[model samples]
Structure formats: structure tokens, C-alpha cells
Target: MERAMGISHFGAAAAACVFMLAQGARAEEAGPHLAIELNAVAPAETGCLISFMARNGHPAAIERAVFETVLIDRAGQVERLTLFDFGDLPAGRPRVRQFSIPGLACDDLGQILINGTSACEAGTLGEAACAEGLDLSSRTDVELIG
Candidate 1:
């Protein structure tokens, strides 16, 4: 009787472990979110050039996405507010967009904030869907926030 109980407990534990692994796999497969990464920053003739790599993990394509972006100075003060239009992001594909801020130096810039979505045009998906599960990352010293 003792040996039978041990085997039964071992089987139940194995089943639970398998179940958890399956759930994790499903979550990875169903990547229902957007990922935005700050690829690079360079100095342009006009000013500071900012490059962003955006990946749409949603099932549908986005016609247009406009984000309310705020540039923060090194002292953590708000520098400027502007609208960055990321046009036509295909589903599961990555897109790169560059913006040049006139009269701003790359070193002086501290952080970039995605205040909110100014506009999002996705078929059957509302504007709020653009920011749904939005993830931000940066490769440079400047921070990227949502």
C-alpha cells in the first residue's frame, strides 16, 4: 500500500509539471502585445536623431499609430511634446521609424516617454488596443517609458 501511494503521488506531480509547461508554451505562442525598442540615437544636421524599432504582436495589422511622446532633459525636466506617427505596422513584423528633433543634442536628452496613443487605426481594434500590453525597452543610456 505504501509503494502504491508513492507511485500515485509521483504521477500527480509529473502531470502538474507538464501542465505548467504547456501553459507557458501557450503564452509564448499567443504573444498578444506590442514591443517597442529604442534602437539607436545619432546626431543629425538638423538635431538629434532617434530610431525606434517597433514590433506588433497583435493578430491584425495596424493602419496607423500616433503616440504622444515627451522628451525629457538630463535634469529630468520635460523638454518637448510631439506626435510620432508610426504608419502601417504589419502584424508580427518589425518596423523602424526615425525622428529628428531640431536643436536638441543626443547627449542632453535624458528619456523618452510615450505618454499615450494619440491615434490608432486598426480594423476591429480600437485606439486603446495600441497601448494594450505595450512593452518598452532601450539599448542606449536614455530611458524609454510608456
Candidate 2:
């Protein structure tokens, strides 16, 4: 009877170890591996345009990518813009996207805040998993805030 009790405890311990290791593996597979570089360029006409680049650094493919951006001016005025949704980005590839802001000029911009990301997914990283892993940078004078 004592021998049977020892075997039961050993089995339980082994099961717990396996469960922990499995969880760790899953976590390792899920993470954000995307980098963003943005620049505000002045057009010949009169307004400003935003140039964006999205690069995937992970081995797995990114299925969907979307971001919510808030543009703040020097006078504390705010304008919200939704970046173009880039779908299906292969690993190690960089995608370029650009858009024009009708009347906002490059100098008028004060700060750009990335409010949130949605529809972000990768092979192992689930939907919206890449939001926290983004490394954002800008070439313009305006500050890129979060």
C-alpha cells in the first residue's frame, strides 16, 4: 500500500512538470515581432503626407495589421486617423503604406499617439498579439508618443 502511494505522488509531480513546460513553450511562440517607421513629408502642393513602413521580424507570417492613431497639434487640437490596414505580411518582409492629410502640414504636427492596434495576428501569436511588441520610430520632427 505504501509503494502504491509513492507512485501516485510521483506521477502527479511528473504531470505538473509537463504542463508547466508546455505552457512555457506556448508563451515563447506567442509575441509581437513588428517594427514601425513613420515620417511626415511635405508635398509640393500644400498639405502633408504620412509615410509608414511595417516590418515583420518574426519567423511566422503576420496575418493582419491595423492601428489607431491620434494626431495632436501644437495648440492641443486633436485629429484621429486610421492607418491603412495591411493584411498578410510574410516574415522578414517590409510593407510600405502612405496617406495624405488634407490640410495638416508637417510642422503643424506636435505628437502622434498610437492609441491601439487591432486585427493583429501572426502564426503563433494570436489576434491582436503584436500590439505590445511594436517598436515605433519616426523620421519627422514630431514626437511619436506610444
Candidate 3:
């Protein structure tokens, strides 16, 4: 009987620990949040491709992300290009989206801009929970401006 009681006590303690762990994860997803970053950029056959890494700093998941970029030529002609939308960007994960801009080369790229995000609806976090948090890194010949 004593052994049976001890076993039950141990089982209860383990269950408590599991519950606490689950709660902690939920809390992290609920706290003040929103973060994303651009890790690299590469030139595609048509235009360019940008890689974005989502850090677990946002309370909501990003379904689709949109960005607008500006390109300049040697003759000082400015052009606007919209990158492809990234889908299902979860926290602490990375996603890549490509854009098609004809006749654009690496050297002609002046700057890249992050216009904003759509379909980034806020979940149970709150109305003010969704935020734009991104970091930019360079892997190509152009400069990125977010």
C-alpha cells in the first residue's frame, strides 16, 4: 500500500510539471510581441528573391507578407517592384519569397523596401498585438531599406 501511494504521488508531480511547461509555452505566445528579419537577398532570373527569418517575438502567426522595393539604374531611373508574398511564416522560422521584375540586374538594384504585410491578422493576442519587426541583411549587390 505504501508503494502504491508513492507511485501515485510521483505521477501527480510529473503531471504538474507537464502542465506548467504547456502554460509557459502559451504565455510566450501571448506576451508582447512581433518580430521578423531579412536574412539574405539573391538575384533571380527575372528579378530577385528575398529571404526573411521570423523570430518568435510576435504574438500572431504571419500568413502572407508583402514588401515593396525600389530599384535605380545607372541613368538614375527609379523603378518600383513588389516582391512575392511569403506564406505561413511561423515564429522562429525562415521563409523566402521571390519577385519578378524584368530586365533587372544585380548592379541595377538600388534599395529594397518593406511596404507592409497583409493577411497578418491578429489572433487571441489582442488588436495591438500584431507588429512589424524585421531585420535586414545583405547577400547581394543592393541595399535594403525597411
lDDT for every model?
0.92, 0.75, 0.56
Q: Considering TM-score, which of the candidate structures 1 and 2 is the better prediction for this target?
A: 1
As for lDDT, the candidate ahead, 1 or 3, is 1
Q: By lDDT, who's the top model here?
A: 1
Q: Candidate 3's residue-wise lDDT over 1-146, tens digit each?
A: 99999999999999999999999997665664544455555678776555555544554565544444455554556766454455555655545544456666756666665555434434554333334334455555555555
Q: Decide which is better by lDDT, 2 or 3.
A: 2
Off by over 4 Å in 2: 1-32, 44-46
Q: TM-scores, in order shown?
A: 0.80, 0.66, 0.53
Residue-by-residue lDDT tens digits, candidate 1, 1-146? 99999999999999999999999997787567778999999999989999999998888899999999999999999999999998989999999999999999999999999999999998876776689888899999999998
Off by over 4 Å in 1: 1-31
What ranking emerges by TM-score with the best candidate at the front? 1, 2, 3
How many clashing pairs per prediction, in order? 0, 0, 5
Query: Across residues 1-146, which tens digit of lDDT does each residue of candidate 2 receive?
Result: 99999999999999999999999896577554677778555663657777777788777888887777788887767865656566777788888877677777778788887778756766576664467667789887777767
The most accurate candidate by TM-score is: 1
Q: How accurate is candidate 1 locally (lDDT)?
A: 0.92
Candidate 3: misplaced stretches above 4 Å? 1-43, 47-50, 54-56, 72-77, 125-131
User: What TM-score would you give candidate 2 relative to the actual structure?
Assistant: 0.66
